[model samples]
Target: MNAERVERIRAALEDAFAPCAVQVADESHRHVGHAGARDGRGHFAVEIVSAAFAGMAPLARHRAVYAALGTLMQTDIHALAIRALTPEEAHAAASRG
Candidate 1:
């Protein structure tokens, strides 16, 4: 696991969204010999709850995240799966449980 890259991603997201909840996971180990992994870049997943996504649609929220990461998207990520939610949405979802 590349701790530096994980930190880099976490820092970028925190800077961009000031998320109430955010988790970044490097799932590359599961990808092993998979095709995109061959490029040396890693696959990641991010779930973030932030007011930055307050009124945005899902695609827009993802685009915001991508923009925040800027050049890192090209330099580091092979694939990213994102789940972005507003604080209210997050709270409501939790309450449902």
Candidate 2:
């Protein structure tokens, strides 16, 4: 749940996708004594809206996000929950809210 690590994640994703919106949340605290947390890595949830995901399938989007994070996936991050969407999907979601 380190702020620095979270910021790094956000920066990397932004650089890769040029996302219109990105939200990164550390969920490590909830995992507490979980096995992965024991190793000092973190769990994170990310919601990103971008043109890069426009025609991608769900799995492809997740893979893209993973690729964006690069080595961070093996170092700073233990688990990731991703909600990737195209700009139009994000706009639709916003309207619903």
Candidate 3:
């Protein structure tokens, strides 16, 4: 279930953004026994770099990603940590790291 959720998120973001880099981390373990995780729902952290996010506000980018996920939010996923960026922004963040 966890792997499937991750793959779904990866595919959705990959198709919508055409990201240069995309990573989806399962964070459900961190919230085990919590309200959402108790039912086997997925908690995820996603980092995506794509030109589709260029000039978009942070909230807008997040909204776009959430929109791409469609009904998954209600049925499978409970939490999402999004780091959406353009290629240049991703590069700059990488250099800082």
Best by TM-score: 2
The candidates, ranked best first by lDDT, are: 2, 1, 3
> In angstroms, how far off is 85's CA in candidate 2?
0.5
Residue-level lDDT tens digits of model 3 in 1-97: 7898899889988888899999999999899789878766788999999999999999999999999989888887999999999999989988999
The sequence of per-residue lDDT tens digits that candidate 2 reaches over residues 1-97 is 4798999999999999999999999999999999889999999999999999988999999999999999999999999999999999999999999
- Model 1 TM-score is 0.94
- Candidate 3 regions exceeding 4 Å error are none
| Candidate 1 structure quality by residue, lDDT tens digits, 1-97 | 4678888999999999999999999998989999999988899999999998987999999999999998889888899999999999999999998
Q: Please, what is the whole-model Cα lDDT of each candidate in the order they appear? A: 0.91, 0.95, 0.91
Lowest summed lDDT over 10 consecutive residues: which window, candidate 1?
A: 1-10
TM-score of each: 0.94, 0.96, 0.94
Error of 2 at 4 (Å): 0.6
Clash counts per candidate, in order, are 0, 0, 0
- Model 2 CA deviation exceeding 4 Å by range: none
Number of backbone clashes in candidate 3: 0
Tell me how far the alpha carbon of residue 69 in candidate 2 is from the true structure, in angstroms, after superposition. 0.4
| lDDT (Cα, 0-100) at 34 in candidate 3 | 90
- Pick by lDDT: which candidate is best? 2
